[model samples]
Target: MTVRILVVDDSPFMRKSLQKMLEEAPDLKVVATARDGIDALEKLEEHKPDLVTLDIEMPRMDGLTCLRKIMATHPLPVLMVSSLTQEGAQATLDALSLGALDFIPKESSFATMSIMQIQQDLQEKVRRLAASPRFHPRPPAEPPAVRPARPAVPSVPISAVPIPAGTALPASPTAELLVIGSSTGGPKALQDILPALPADLPVPCLIVQHMPSTFTRPFADRLDGLCQVHVKEAEQGEPLKAGTVYIAPGGIHMLYGARGPKGCVELTPEPVSSLHRPSVDVLFQSVADHYRGQVLATILTGMGADGAKGMEQLKRKGAHTLAESEESCVVYGMPRAAVERGCVDLVAPLPDIAGHLRRHFRL
Candidate 1:
């Protein structure tokens, strides 16, 4: 089937370029091109394309604002075209939270990149998104009847297993950091886990969620408001602290490392590895290298084997590992891969993960 696309950008050259590129694919078509968000909205009524490729920077209405409106009114899948700068990264992430499906970097030389290479990437993204199910805007479901909030409970530290002679384990449980890897249904899964955590939880949580840049901060902000713990986008050399969650920003990798007197989170602008920025593998590998038995690795719902290898590293290093079970996942790919590799120490449903975490920490 032909995948219909609406191309939205302020640059006439960009719009034309995208149109030409997409038209060359037998299974894809640029049904419409809009110079900006207003024009895109107008074209939406006329063409009803199956997907949209949006530019982050635009006059009158920016991509994010347009994305929010699109998600609210139309809810078609959108892939953002963003620059590599920090501002662009932030905006791209915001777009993701606003419900854009994914993004491609709009480098200054993107136009001159091998047309064949660009075409291949564009086709893959468009086909994947088009084939994926779309999220429709719906009224909020009524909340379940309120019950008494669970009382705060102190977490008991799990007895640390000794690392191998060559490996390292932190001297205290407080020195350990939790590294979480997730994708697909991660945002909702994180909401379920974080908000239920007590204010005094004893370890910092570092999360690698498969998402574009601007969206992670908003996702973190949403978590911060609802959860007892503080949530923020991870920064370079940021010290991990108890009762806090750090989400890796999109378009960059977040690695675990020793900073000064202790281990902390580090951000790297490394080229995409394993087809993802903020790769689960990079985070897991780093944790294994630095924290060894002090790490707790959990692989959640996602579409690939991105975390499986890293989970194996963590398991070999004697860190406890968990996987979200099949019944609870939007896609069973990542967790399933980890489980099959014998890397998962336990498999639990989404609702049960928090309880297991509480039990593990003895909270």
Candidate 2:
């Protein structure tokens, strides 16, 4: 089935470029184009497209306002077109928080007529968003007024079914470090999971979320304010500490390593051949090398098989591994890949993941 798309951007060149790129794929069709948010709304009502490619910085009604309107009135899959600037990064993060399915970075001035990267990213994201049955706007989240105290986790009876969908068996206490990987619908998923973890978590957490370099810091900051555990973007050479969540910055790989007396995060661009800069395989394999059976690794929602190989390595080393259940995943790709590889120890839905972690870590 051909996926109908509405392209919204103030730049005529960008709109044309996007339309051209998308139409190149036989499955994708640009049904209409809108210059700004107001026009985009009208186009949305008129075209009722399967997906929308929205630009964040537009005159008249901004993309965020338009996205808010879309989610409020008629929630659908919306992919944001964002610039690589810091301001653009902030707005894109806001858009994701507002329920955009994903985003593709745009260059300033739309100078390049033929952008291979943007074209490839646009086509893939649009098609996936259109075809995904799980694609739905995330419910709007009100930013917490203040950093919240750790919410209490109520105890439940241990179930005979050891790996039930919602319940978790007590996890082994030997696991010392926690590493998580996600993509596609990860921002909202992370928001759901991270804040629920107690502030006094016994082990440090490392997260690899596929995102642009400019956006990671802001994303981490947003999570920091909302979560009980201290969350921040990982800095090179910083010691990995318990009760802290380190988010890998975009455009680079983050790995586990020791700095003489303390274990620290090592950011590198080597093996630049990897598909994703902050590749899950890179991080997971590193943990497998250092901690082996002492690690707890998870593959959350994402678009590709990046983490599956790493999960296999971890599993061989006796690490406890979890995959987000399909019913709870936005894309179900990464976790599905890991599960198919026979590496996942638990398959849990999004709401239950943090609880499982709490149980495993004895938080």
Candidate 3:
């Protein structure tokens, strides 16, 4: 199916470049180009495109403003085009919160990279998003009351008995660690799930959301602000703590080592063979090695099979696993792959995920 798109950017050169790249794939059709947020709104009405590729920094109305307007009225898939800068990362996250579906990060050295690679990445995102246009759970009309993310909770035991293939334990309420992986549609998916987690959640959660190094800090900060669970980018050698969500830094792998109730962070830059830097497989494998039967792993929306193998490792180690069902996933690749591998114990829709987690850990 051809995914109709409108490219919105203030830069003429970038707009044309993106257009040429997208046209390389027959499935992606650039229906119009908008110079800024104002132009984007006008073109949205005129073209009625299936999706929009929006640039965050634009004159005469920024991408965030345009995104708010679009999500309020038209509510189409909008992918933010962001730069790999601190400021760009923060604004792109703002776009996500305002209901942008996904994002593509641009580097300052974009001219130095191969356009072919960019074309493939861009087209793939467009194809996946247009194919699955279900809306994410929108935030409420009024903000939910802000409870502190970490309230004191009772300690729970960690099970050591291994769970066999095709088997799952009932919700233990004692799961000691929670790890999550996502890519294409993560930010919005997380928005739906994280805010609903109980303030006194007992597990320490680590996340590997496929994003640029520049983006992770701001993304974590944004989630921290909005979520009942405290969120932050993982720091090397920091001990794991309950009720906090640690996002893997963008360019480094977040591996766990010397496991216990108090596990220390282990970051690595080697083994750059994977498609993503803070690889889901790397993190999952590390957790499976140490946490074993005490773990609870979740695979959310993404475009690749990065987490499948590691999820398999976790499953083999008796960890309970959950995969987002296809109906709720924006791009169902990672979770589908894990499901195909027989690694997943439960298949739940996006909105039910928070409840599933709560019931599992009895938080």
Candidate 4:
């Protein structure tokens, strides 16, 4: 099926470039382009495109405002295009919370961007969003966003289920550390899970969220304001402390090591060549080596399989692992990959994850 798209950006050049990039995918067709939010809505009603690539900064209504209005009124998958600056990062995170599905950052000049990365990312995201059953179907007048929510993964019952044959469920450890990794739909997913965790959570939590260099700090700020647990972007050589959540800063890999006998975070100097700098695999591998059997790793909703190998390593080392179930995932790629590799001990929905953590940690 042909995937219809709407390009919404204030710049005519950007709109054309984006259109050109997207249309390069044989299955994708950019049906319309808008100069801003108001124009976007007009085109939205006219074209009823399968997906929208929305720019954050625009003339009248901004992307965040438009996102809220769209989610409240139209209810379709909207991916945001944002600058990679500090402000851009915050707005992108805001857009995500307001129901934008995902985002890609544009650097100083949109034209100077590495087209190859943008092209690949654009094609992939458009195709994935289009494949969803929620995209526009035959009935033109029918609403797109009025679909029912998927059932979350059921909570871990009082009496745990038997372990599947080959993998041994680690004897429930008095979990000392919790490591989390997410991307794409991560901000909202993290919001759903993090705030609900008790302020006195027994272990320190480490997170590797895929974001741009300037975005992680603002993201942490937002999470800190909302969550009971103190959330901050992780820093180099900082000692790991309980009851606080450390978000791996963007553009660097976060790993675990020790300062003398005290366990501390190692923020590396240079960015790795991996697709993601704050790679989940880097963090998870560190946990596998340092925490071994004393850790609990949670893989949340994201676009790629980054955390899968890391989760596998954690699982093999007897760490308890959880993957968010598909019904509760905005993008099930990461969790699905972990489950496929037999890394998770349980698969829970977004809502039940916190409770599951409490139960496992005996909170």
Best by TM-score: 2
Model 1 error, position 230 (Å): 4.3
The C-alpha stretches of model 2 lying farther than 4 A from their native spots are 136-170, 260-262
lDDT of 1 by residue, 1-363 (tens): 999999999999889888888888898999899988999999999999999999988999989889988988888889889886767766765676677766777877876786666676777777766655344323567989989999889999886532223112222343256789998767767878988889888888889998667567767877898899899999888787888889999889999877754468789877554588989999888888877447778888777788899989988977777788766665567888887787776777788888877766766
Predicted candidate 4 versus true structure: per-residue lDDT over 1-363, tens digit per residue: 898999999988889889999888888999999998999998989999888999998989888788887888788889898898888888888888878888877767667756886789888988776553333333445567767888898778585433234222244666788899998778888988888887998788999988887988999999999988899999888888788999998888999875533378898844457778989998898878876338888899888899999999988887888887777677778988888887688887778887878777666
Candidate 1 wrong stretches, greater than 4 Å: 59-61, 108-118, 133-176, 182-199, 209-239, 246-278, 289-294, 300-303, 316-319, 323-336, 339-342, 345-363
TM-score of each: 0.67, 0.89, 0.86, 0.87
**Candidate 1 TM-score, true structure as reference:** 0.67
For each candidate, what is the lDDT? 0.79, 0.87, 0.85, 0.82
In candidate 4, the residue pairs with backbone N, CA or C atoms under 3 Å apart (3 or more residues apart, or in different chains) clash, namely: 153-349
TM-score of 4: 0.87
Q: How many clashing residue pairs, candidate 3?
A: 1
Instruction: Tell me the tens digit of each residue's lDDT in model 2 across 1-363.
Output: 899999999989889988988899898999999999999999988989999999988999999999999989878889999988999988888898898888888888567445776677778878777765466445668887986789889989874423324345336655778899999999989999999998999788899999989899999999999999999999999998889999999999999985633378999997799999999999998888875337888989888898999999988988888888877777878998898787788898889998888888877
Kindly state the number of residue pairs that clash in model 2. Answer: 0
By lDDT: ranked, best first = 2, 3, 4, 1
- Stretches of candidate 4 off by over 4 Å are 132-171, 260-262, 269-271
Best by lDDT: 2
